[model samples]
Target: MELIRYAFVGVLNTGLGYAVIFLCMGVLDWSPVASNIAGYAVGFVVSFTLNRSFTFRSKGPARRELRRFLLIFALAYLANLAVLVLCVHAMGLDGGWAQVIAGFGYFGLSFALSKYYVFAEGAGHRDAGSTGHV
Candidate 1:
Protein backbone atom coordinates (compact mmCIF):
# COMPACT_ATOMS: atom_id res chain seq x y z
CA MET A 1 0.00 0.00 0.00
CA GLU A 2 0.96 3.63 -0.41
CA LEU A 3 1.04 4.13 3.33
CA ILE A 4 3.46 1.26 3.70
CA ARG A 5 5.81 2.77 1.15
CA TYR A 6 5.62 6.13 2.83
CA ALA A 7 6.45 4.55 6.17
CA PHE A 8 9.37 2.68 4.63
CA VAL A 9 10.73 5.90 3.19
CA GLY A 10 10.28 7.61 6.54
CA VAL A 11 12.27 4.96 8.31
CA LEU A 12 15.08 5.18 5.78
CA ASN A 13 15.10 8.95 5.96
CA THR A 14 15.18 8.92 9.75
CA GLY A 15 18.11 6.53 9.89
CA LEU A 16 20.10 8.43 7.30
CA GLY A 17 19.32 11.78 8.89
CA TYR A 18 20.39 10.65 12.34
CA ALA A 19 23.61 9.22 10.96
CA VAL A 20 24.41 12.50 9.24
CA ILE A 21 23.55 14.48 12.34
CA PHE A 22 25.79 12.40 14.57
CA LEU A 23 28.61 12.46 12.06
CA CYS A 24 28.49 16.20 11.74
CA MET A 25 28.37 16.74 15.48
CA GLY A 26 30.89 14.11 16.57
CA VAL A 27 33.36 14.00 13.73
CA LEU A 28 33.04 17.43 12.12
CA ASP A 29 32.77 19.30 15.42
CA TRP A 30 29.62 21.06 14.41
CA SER A 31 27.13 22.62 16.77
CA PRO A 32 23.98 20.67 17.52
CA VAL A 33 21.89 23.19 15.61
CA ALA A 34 24.17 23.06 12.60
CA SER A 35 24.27 19.30 12.63
CA ASN A 36 20.52 19.12 12.89
CA ILE A 37 20.16 21.46 9.95
CA ALA A 38 22.52 19.39 7.85
CA GLY A 39 20.69 16.21 8.70
CA TYR A 40 17.32 17.72 7.81
CA ALA A 41 18.64 19.05 4.54
CA VAL A 42 19.59 15.55 3.51
CA GLY A 43 16.26 14.24 4.70
CA PHE A 44 14.35 16.82 2.72
CA VAL A 45 15.85 15.73 -0.56
CA VAL A 46 15.64 12.01 0.16
CA SER A 47 12.08 12.22 1.40
CA PHE A 48 10.89 14.09 -1.64
CA THR A 49 12.62 11.83 -4.11
CA LEU A 50 11.47 8.61 -2.53
CA ASN A 51 7.96 9.74 -1.82
CA ARG A 52 7.50 10.99 -5.35
CA SER A 53 9.00 8.08 -7.24
CA PHE A 54 8.45 5.16 -4.92
CA THR A 55 5.50 5.91 -2.67
CA PHE A 56 3.24 7.95 -4.90
CA ARG A 57 4.48 6.94 -8.32
CA SER A 58 3.75 10.45 -9.39
CA LYS A 59 4.54 11.65 -12.87
CA GLY A 60 4.10 15.31 -11.92
CA PRO A 61 6.63 18.04 -12.54
CA ALA A 62 9.38 17.78 -9.96
CA ARG A 63 9.59 21.52 -9.37
CA ARG A 64 5.90 21.90 -8.58
CA GLU A 65 5.81 18.91 -6.29
CA LEU A 66 9.00 20.01 -4.59
CA ARG A 67 7.63 23.44 -3.83
CA ARG A 68 4.49 21.99 -2.29
CA PHE A 69 6.53 19.43 -0.42
CA LEU A 70 8.67 22.18 1.07
CA LEU A 71 5.61 23.99 2.29
CA ILE A 72 4.15 20.85 3.84
CA PHE A 73 7.44 19.89 5.43
CA ALA A 74 7.79 23.30 7.06
CA LEU A 75 4.26 23.19 8.43
CA ALA A 76 4.70 19.67 9.77
CA TYR A 77 8.05 20.50 11.32
CA LEU A 78 6.63 23.51 13.09
CA ALA A 79 3.82 21.37 14.45
CA ASN A 80 6.34 18.81 15.58
CA LEU A 81 8.35 21.46 17.43
CA ALA A 82 5.22 22.83 19.05
CA VAL A 83 4.27 19.36 20.24
CA LEU A 84 7.77 18.77 21.57
CA VAL A 85 7.78 22.03 23.52
CA LEU A 86 4.35 21.40 24.94
CA CYS A 87 5.25 17.91 26.03
CA VAL A 88 8.53 18.90 27.60
CA HIS A 89 7.74 22.27 29.18
CA ALA A 90 4.02 22.10 29.86
CA MET A 91 3.55 18.42 30.56
CA GLY A 92 6.94 17.98 32.23
CA LEU A 93 7.84 15.00 30.10
CA ASP A 94 11.41 13.95 29.43
CA GLY A 95 12.97 15.53 26.34
CA GLY A 96 13.60 12.18 24.67
CA TRP A 97 10.05 11.02 25.23
CA ALA A 98 8.69 14.33 24.04
CA GLN A 99 10.73 14.02 20.87
CA VAL A 100 9.25 10.59 20.28
CA ILE A 101 5.74 11.95 20.64
CA ALA A 102 6.54 14.88 18.40
CA GLY A 103 7.94 12.58 15.77
CA PHE A 104 4.59 10.83 15.44
CA GLY A 105 2.87 14.14 14.90
CA TYR A 106 5.43 15.02 12.27
CA PHE A 107 5.00 11.71 10.50
CA GLY A 108 1.22 11.85 10.39
CA LEU A 109 1.07 15.40 9.12
CA SER A 110 3.76 14.86 6.57
CA PHE A 111 2.07 11.76 5.18
CA ALA A 112 -1.34 13.36 4.95
CA LEU A 113 -0.03 16.52 3.29
CA SER A 114 2.10 14.57 0.87
CA LYS A 115 -0.74 12.26 -0.07
CA TYR A 116 -3.51 14.80 -0.39
CA TYR A 117 -1.77 17.95 -1.61
CA VAL A 118 1.69 17.31 -2.95
CA PHE A 119 1.29 14.04 -4.82
CA ALA A 120 -2.40 13.51 -5.11
CA GLU A 121 -3.56 11.68 -8.23
CA GLY A 122 -4.34 14.06 -11.10
CA ALA A 123 -2.76 17.00 -9.29
CA GLY A 124 -0.44 17.40 -12.24
CA HIS A 125 0.05 14.16 -14.13
CA ARG A 126 -1.60 10.85 -13.47
CA ASP A 127 0.09 8.42 -11.10
CA ALA A 128 1.16 4.97 -12.16
CA GLY A 129 -0.63 1.88 -10.96
CA SER A 130 0.71 0.05 -7.92
CA THR A 131 3.55 -1.86 -9.49
CA GLY A 132 5.62 -1.91 -6.33
CA HIS A 133 8.65 -0.64 -8.23
CA VAL A 134 10.84 2.29 -7.39
Candidate 2:
Protein backbone atom coordinates (compact mmCIF):
# COMPACT_ATOMS: atom_id res chain seq x y z
CA MET A 1 0.00 0.00 0.00
CA GLU A 2 2.78 2.39 0.91
CA LEU A 3 4.70 1.42 -2.19
CA ILE A 4 1.64 2.04 -4.29
CA ARG A 5 1.17 5.51 -2.88
CA TYR A 6 4.85 6.24 -3.31
CA ALA A 7 4.64 5.27 -6.96
CA PHE A 8 1.72 7.60 -7.47
CA VAL A 9 3.64 10.42 -5.86
CA GLY A 10 6.73 9.50 -7.83
CA VAL A 11 4.87 9.94 -11.07
CA LEU A 12 3.87 13.45 -10.17
CA ASN A 13 7.34 14.29 -8.92
CA THR A 14 8.91 12.83 -12.04
CA GLY A 15 6.81 15.05 -14.20
CA LEU A 16 7.90 18.14 -12.28
CA GLY A 17 11.50 17.03 -12.31
CA TYR A 18 11.58 16.41 -16.04
CA ALA A 19 9.87 19.68 -16.79
CA VAL A 20 12.35 21.66 -14.70
CA ILE A 21 15.30 19.80 -16.15
CA PHE A 22 14.06 20.35 -19.68
CA LEU A 23 13.52 24.03 -19.09
CA CYS A 24 16.90 24.41 -17.49
CA MET A 25 19.07 22.33 -19.79
CA GLY A 26 17.18 22.57 -23.07
CA VAL A 27 15.87 26.10 -22.80
CA LEU A 28 18.06 27.98 -20.36
CA ASP A 29 21.18 26.00 -21.31
CA TRP A 30 22.07 25.36 -17.68
CA SER A 31 24.57 22.64 -16.82
CA PRO A 32 23.27 19.19 -15.98
CA VAL A 33 24.12 19.54 -12.32
CA ALA A 34 22.43 22.91 -12.07
CA SER A 35 19.38 21.67 -13.86
CA ASN A 36 19.17 18.59 -11.68
CA ILE A 37 19.45 20.69 -8.56
CA ALA A 38 16.68 22.98 -9.70
CA GLY A 39 14.43 20.07 -10.51
CA TYR A 40 15.07 18.51 -7.12
CA ALA A 41 14.27 21.67 -5.21
CA VAL A 42 10.97 21.97 -7.00
CA GLY A 43 10.04 18.34 -6.44
CA PHE A 44 11.07 18.28 -2.79
CA VAL A 45 8.17 20.37 -1.56
CA VAL A 46 5.59 18.22 -3.26
CA SER A 47 7.24 14.95 -2.28
CA PHE A 48 7.55 15.91 1.35
CA THR A 49 3.93 16.94 1.68
CA LEU A 50 2.54 13.87 -0.02
CA ASN A 51 4.83 11.44 1.72
CA ARG A 52 4.01 12.94 5.09
CA SER A 53 0.28 13.18 4.65
CA PHE A 54 -0.81 10.40 2.31
CA THR A 55 2.10 8.02 1.76
CA PHE A 56 3.53 7.17 5.17
CA ARG A 57 0.83 9.08 6.97
CA SER A 58 3.50 10.51 9.19
CA LYS A 59 2.47 12.15 12.46
CA GLY A 60 5.91 13.56 13.12
CA PRO A 61 6.68 17.16 13.69
CA ALA A 62 7.45 19.07 10.55
CA ARG A 63 10.95 20.17 11.52
CA ARG A 64 12.29 16.72 12.30
CA GLU A 65 10.77 15.27 9.20
CA LEU A 66 12.00 18.17 7.14
CA ARG A 67 15.54 17.70 8.38
CA ARG A 68 15.52 14.00 7.72
CA PHE A 69 13.92 14.58 4.38
CA LEU A 70 16.66 17.04 3.47
CA LEU A 71 19.32 14.54 4.38
CA ILE A 72 17.70 11.83 2.29
CA PHE A 73 17.37 14.14 -0.66
CA ALA A 74 20.94 15.30 -0.26
CA LEU A 75 22.07 11.71 -0.69
CA ALA A 76 19.65 11.34 -3.58
CA TYR A 77 21.00 14.40 -5.30
CA LEU A 78 24.57 13.23 -5.08
CA ALA A 79 23.73 9.74 -6.26
CA ASN A 80 21.64 10.93 -9.15
CA LEU A 81 24.24 13.49 -10.09
CA ALA A 82 26.76 10.70 -10.33
CA VAL A 83 24.39 8.78 -12.56
CA LEU A 84 23.83 11.80 -14.75
CA VAL A 85 27.56 12.37 -15.08
CA LEU A 86 28.20 8.77 -15.98
CA CYS A 87 25.45 8.74 -18.55
CA VAL A 88 26.65 11.91 -20.18
CA HIS A 89 30.39 11.27 -20.13
CA ALA A 90 30.66 7.52 -20.45
CA MET A 91 27.44 6.65 -22.26
CA GLY A 92 27.55 9.60 -24.65
CA LEU A 93 24.16 10.96 -23.76
CA ASP A 94 23.08 14.55 -23.63
CA GLY A 95 22.42 16.26 -20.29
CA GLY A 96 18.66 16.20 -20.74
CA TRP A 97 18.66 12.54 -21.70
CA ALA A 98 20.96 11.65 -18.83
CA GLN A 99 18.54 13.27 -16.39
CA VAL A 100 15.75 11.06 -17.66
CA ILE A 101 17.79 7.94 -16.95
CA ALA A 102 18.95 9.17 -13.55
CA GLY A 103 15.37 9.70 -12.40
CA PHE A 104 14.72 5.95 -12.23
CA GLY A 105 17.53 5.22 -9.80
CA TYR A 106 16.87 8.32 -7.73
CA PHE A 107 13.23 7.37 -7.21
CA GLY A 108 14.22 4.01 -5.74
CA LEU A 109 16.63 5.58 -3.32
CA SER A 110 14.13 8.21 -2.19
CA PHE A 111 11.41 5.64 -1.57
CA ALA A 112 13.69 3.49 0.59
CA LEU A 113 14.80 6.45 2.62
CA SER A 114 11.24 7.57 3.11
CA LYS A 115 10.06 4.18 4.28
CA TYR A 116 12.88 3.47 6.71
CA TYR A 117 14.95 6.38 7.84
CA VAL A 118 12.58 9.28 7.36
CA PHE A 119 9.12 7.94 8.18
CA ALA A 120 9.81 4.70 9.93
CA GLU A 121 7.27 2.76 12.05
CA GLY A 122 7.94 4.44 15.36
CA ALA A 123 8.83 7.50 17.40
CA GLY A 124 7.81 10.15 14.96
CA HIS A 125 5.46 8.43 12.58
CA ARG A 126 2.30 6.38 12.89
CA ASP A 127 2.31 2.65 13.47
CA ALA A 128 -0.18 -0.23 13.18
CA GLY A 129 -3.12 0.59 15.42
CA SER A 130 -2.39 4.16 16.35
CA THR A 131 -4.61 6.82 14.93
CA GLY A 132 -1.38 8.62 13.89
CA HIS A 133 -3.29 11.81 13.74
CA VAL A 134 -1.61 14.86 15.08
Candidate 3:
Protein backbone atom coordinates (compact mmCIF):
# COMPACT_ATOMS: atom_id res chain seq x y z
CA MET A 1 0.00 0.00 0.00
CA GLU A 2 2.73 2.43 0.97
CA LEU A 3 4.81 1.48 -2.06
CA ILE A 4 1.82 1.95 -4.31
CA ARG A 5 1.23 5.44 -2.96
CA TYR A 6 4.87 6.27 -3.39
CA ALA A 7 4.87 5.20 -7.03
CA PHE A 8 1.68 7.12 -7.65
CA VAL A 9 3.19 10.27 -6.22
CA GLY A 10 6.33 9.68 -8.24
CA VAL A 11 4.31 9.58 -11.43
CA LEU A 12 2.61 12.81 -10.46
CA ASN A 13 5.95 14.39 -9.70
CA THR A 14 7.32 13.32 -13.09
CA GLY A 15 4.33 14.77 -14.90
CA LEU A 16 4.56 18.02 -13.00
CA GLY A 17 8.24 18.23 -13.69
CA TYR A 18 7.77 17.69 -17.41
CA ALA A 19 5.08 20.31 -17.50
CA VAL A 20 7.39 22.83 -15.93
CA ILE A 21 10.14 21.97 -18.38
CA PHE A 22 7.84 22.30 -21.33
CA LEU A 23 6.57 25.64 -20.19
CA CYS A 24 10.05 26.91 -19.54
CA MET A 25 11.41 25.75 -22.86
CA GLY A 26 8.47 26.52 -25.09
CA VAL A 27 7.04 29.63 -23.48
CA LEU A 28 10.04 31.23 -21.87
CA ASP A 29 12.58 30.00 -24.44
CA TRP A 30 14.92 28.69 -21.79
CA SER A 31 17.77 26.34 -22.48
CA PRO A 32 17.04 22.63 -22.10
CA VAL A 33 19.41 22.31 -19.15
CA ALA A 34 17.94 25.29 -17.39
CA SER A 35 14.42 24.11 -18.02
CA ASN A 36 15.27 20.70 -16.69
CA ILE A 37 16.76 22.20 -13.57
CA ALA A 38 13.64 24.25 -12.97
CA GLY A 39 11.46 21.23 -13.54
CA TYR A 40 13.41 19.12 -11.08
CA ALA A 41 13.27 21.82 -8.45
CA VAL A 42 9.51 22.00 -8.58
CA GLY A 43 9.24 18.25 -8.78
CA PHE A 44 11.37 17.84 -5.69
CA VAL A 45 8.98 19.86 -3.58
CA VAL A 46 5.94 18.06 -4.89
CA SER A 47 7.57 14.66 -4.39
CA PHE A 48 8.45 15.45 -0.82
CA THR A 49 4.97 16.66 0.04
CA LEU A 50 3.12 13.79 -1.56
CA ASN A 51 5.46 11.13 -0.32
CA ARG A 52 5.22 12.44 3.21
CA SER A 53 1.46 12.97 3.50
CA PHE A 54 0.10 10.23 1.29
CA THR A 55 2.77 7.57 1.08
CA PHE A 56 4.39 7.49 4.47
CA ARG A 57 1.81 9.17 6.70
CA SER A 58 4.65 10.63 8.74
CA LYS A 59 4.07 12.66 11.89
CA GLY A 60 7.23 14.66 12.33
CA PRO A 61 8.60 18.20 12.47
CA ALA A 62 8.83 19.93 9.11
CA ARG A 63 12.22 21.48 9.80
CA ARG A 64 13.98 18.21 10.51
CA GLU A 65 12.46 16.44 7.54
CA LEU A 66 13.23 19.33 5.25
CA ARG A 67 16.89 19.39 6.24
CA ARG A 68 17.24 15.64 5.82
CA PHE A 69 15.44 15.81 2.48
CA LEU A 70 17.81 18.48 1.25
CA LEU A 71 20.82 16.41 2.18
CA ILE A 72 19.48 13.26 0.55
CA PHE A 73 18.47 15.06 -2.62
CA ALA A 74 21.83 16.77 -2.90
CA LEU A 75 23.57 13.43 -2.79
CA ALA A 76 21.09 11.96 -5.24
CA TYR A 77 21.70 14.83 -7.65
CA LEU A 78 25.46 14.31 -7.53
CA ALA A 79 25.07 10.57 -8.05
CA ASN A 80 22.83 11.07 -11.05
CA LEU A 81 25.30 13.48 -12.55
CA ALA A 82 28.12 11.01 -12.00
CA VAL A 83 26.11 8.23 -13.66
CA LEU A 84 25.30 10.43 -16.62
CA VAL A 85 28.92 11.40 -17.12
CA LEU A 86 30.10 7.82 -16.76
CA CYS A 87 27.55 6.51 -19.22
CA VAL A 88 28.17 9.12 -21.86
CA HIS A 89 31.95 9.38 -21.61
CA ALA A 90 33.10 5.98 -20.42
CA MET A 91 30.43 3.79 -22.05
CA GLY A 92 30.17 5.90 -25.21
CA LEU A 93 26.43 6.30 -24.88
CA ASP A 94 24.56 9.25 -26.29
CA GLY A 95 23.95 12.03 -23.78
CA GLY A 96 20.17 11.75 -23.92
CA TRP A 97 20.28 7.98 -23.58
CA ALA A 98 22.70 8.24 -20.73
CA GLN A 99 20.39 10.60 -18.92
CA VAL A 100 17.51 8.17 -19.34
CA ILE A 101 19.52 5.38 -17.75
CA ALA A 102 20.72 7.64 -15.02
CA GLY A 103 17.16 8.75 -14.31
CA PHE A 104 16.14 5.16 -13.57
CA GLY A 105 19.03 4.72 -11.19
CA TYR A 106 18.10 7.97 -9.52
CA PHE A 107 14.53 6.85 -9.10
CA GLY A 108 15.52 3.67 -7.31
CA LEU A 109 18.07 5.38 -5.15
CA SER A 110 15.65 8.20 -4.32
CA PHE A 111 13.00 5.73 -3.28
CA ALA A 112 15.31 3.89 -0.93
CA LEU A 113 16.72 7.05 0.54
CA SER A 114 13.28 8.55 1.00
CA LYS A 115 12.06 5.46 2.77
CA TYR A 116 14.99 4.74 5.06
CA TYR A 117 16.68 8.06 5.62
CA VAL A 118 14.46 11.04 4.89
CA PHE A 119 11.24 9.37 5.89
CA ALA A 120 12.29 6.84 8.46
CA GLU A 121 9.71 5.67 11.00
CA GLY A 122 11.62 7.02 13.95
CA ALA A 123 14.44 9.28 15.15
CA GLY A 124 12.40 12.10 16.69
CA HIS A 125 10.00 12.02 13.75
CA ARG A 126 7.71 9.30 12.45
CA ASP A 127 4.33 7.68 12.85
CA ALA A 128 3.91 3.99 13.34
CA GLY A 129 5.71 2.87 10.21
CA SER A 130 4.61 6.00 8.36
CA THR A 131 6.14 9.42 7.45
CA GLY A 132 4.99 13.05 6.90
CA HIS A 133 5.13 16.48 5.08
CA VAL A 134 7.39 17.97 2.38
* Cα lDDT tens digits for candidate 3, 11-110: 9999999999999999999999999999999998998888777776666776788788888888887889999999999999999999999988887787
Clashing pairs for model 1 are none
lDDT of 1 by residue, 4-118 (tens): 9899999999999999999999999999999999999998899999999888878777899999999999999999999999999999999999999999999999999998999
Q: Using Cα atoms with residue i matched to residue i, what is each candidate's TM-score against the true structure? A: 0.80, 0.66, 0.75
- Put down candidate 2 lDDT per residue, 1-134, tens digits, no spaces: 78888999988987998899889999999999999989988888888988888888877777888899999988987999999999999999989989988987788898899888888743334566766553
Which is the leading candidate under TM-score?
Answer: 1
Check candidate 3 and list the clashing pairs.
Answer: 56-131, 57-131, 58-131, 58-132
Clashes of 1: 0
The regions of model 3 sitting more than 4 angstroms off are 24-38, 122-134
Show the colliding residue pairs in model 2.
none
1 or 2, greater by TM-score: 1
lDDT for each of the candidates?
A: 0.90, 0.85, 0.82
